[model samples]
Target: MKKKGNKPLLDMLQNIAEGLGETLSPFCEVVVHDLRNPKNAIHGIYNNLSGRHIGDPATELGLARIRDPEFPPRLSNYANTFPDGRKVKSTSIGIKDENGEYVAALCLNVDLTLFQSFQGAISQFTRIEDGRVHEDLERTPAERIHARIDEFAASRATTARSLNAADRKQLVQELKKEGLLEIRRGANIAATHMGVSRATVYGDAK
Candidate 1:
């Protein structure tokens, strides 16, 4: 162990870890490790996601940095796992002293379990059916049928309920040919719009 007394640098890293942990709250774990003391390198831990405590030994990466001077100063978005196999995305940053010796590290670990579950749910919810009818959900069948009748009546200079017998018979025949009289409760719907009995609408449709 180098056993350097760089309390200010370690304190700063701890402060940063605390702020970041609070900002990302309950999902991220931020840890500050004092590399000079390999046996008890964990100086401070915030959010405590991995269930590690202060005074824990240096991690593999931290130990590597302590031994090898040529190691990369930063590793970002690296894949990691917790003790129980929970997935994690981690970033490890090695802090160096003024003499260019590795002094401390600030690490961030983000728990991705919740986000992965959410992604799966979203994918399932948005899955498209391969074969489905094109449906008009904005209007009911009755409203569309009434609108069609009103359009047909307007062309004859009358309203749906004011059509003469000959005109009304022609309307029912045209509606039947268009399959409008084949819908559910077709005769009743036609009667309501034509101001006639359902039997009259059915008879006219034939």
Candidate 2:
């Protein structure tokens, strides 16, 4: 039989665990099933690259390890979730056994409810939706812009010779600041503009 004092501690621990599990149920579902769609495709391509799966041999080996089971441990995983008319940020961690083998994964989904509201308020205050300019959130915003400009120039059967580097960068920066980049136009945009595999773009973006 358990001692009276120990019984209380056990009860408290159980309660805490249950509470945490309840809080994270939605996020866990998304990580395992929802996020895995793209992840699996990425793995398939990587496997093909390593000759573990049958596919075109022309596949580059650089990205082969992304799907490798032997890939290094990751501390956390991040994804975005849209639920109840709000967007939430989700994070998940791998649960490991005593011997350091992964047993299962535990996830935490946080609703950035307040932050989203705060952003809206700030946007209104600064009249960002108006003709005013804004800053880009992507770290490589300038590079991304340059890439987009190059693609646009090429599609028009022209080159960057028509637009200076500064001009192209400015256009990209302006587009980013206006939140135009966040709008999703499906897999085609990512594939055409970014030169990334459809799987990678859909998986991460979805």
Candidate 3:
């Protein structure tokens, strides 16, 4: 059977490229290169994140493939860069004919800036601070109340007794929400810990 030119294979790859471009969306760039014509290799571009267009020259890898057909057919997750200096993670695949001649190439370049920023946010969210840790086993009602008070004070960089009026009012409201004030002598306990009178705690709660 006499072989056809690169059209049929190019058409098939173009379909696959369109699907991948739509599926991967804005983060990925997909480029189709017609290897037969190195100078005007870019046949089409999809999800064009790299700022390239049709009729662009083939990449160095494509040129290498043409210069030496023995070159690797696929190189995946290779490091690359955009013209704006953003990082790129890329993959390229060379398509060959029945005669094993390089006919075309498909290149996928993924924008890593978004992922890198997301990774930073995740790292900050999941980070753990060192020391000054307290685990409330709820050993006793009074202990739970006092521990929570201590934690609240520690967060404000002050001792329970040193809490100002604003801090005290906020703490009293939060303590009431947790039903800490409902415990027996809880008001007395809070008054003693904070060096305040029962009347003051009650006023803060009101």
lDDT of each: 0.90, 0.41, 0.90
lDDT of 2 by residue, 1-206 (tens): 22233334334433544566455543322221111122332111110111222122211222332244343344344545443555555544433334443323323445566767889999889863656787777736445544665776676566644544444445445444555456554344434454545564444443
Return the lDDT, model 1, position 169.
89
State candidate 1's TM-score: 0.63
Return the clash pairs for model 2, or none. none
Give the least accurate 10-residue stretch of model 2, judged by summed lDDT.
41-50
Instruction: Kindly report which residue pairs in candidate 3 clash with one another.
Output: none
| Native-to-model Cα distance after best TM-score fit, residue 29 in candidate 3, in Å | 0.5
Q: RMSD for each model, in Å, please?
A: 17.3, 23.1, 15.1
Of the candidates numbered 1 and 2, which has the greater TM-score value?
1
Evaluated against the true structure, the overall lDDT of model 3 is: 0.90
TM-scores of all candidate predictions against the true structure: 0.63, 0.28, 0.63
Error of 3 at 9 (Å): 0.6
lDDT of 3 by residue, 1-206 (tens): 12248888888889999899999998999888998989999998999898888998988889999788788999999999999999999999998888888889998999999999999999999998778696765468888888989999999999999999999999999999999999999998988989999999999999
Error of 3 at 159 (Å): 50
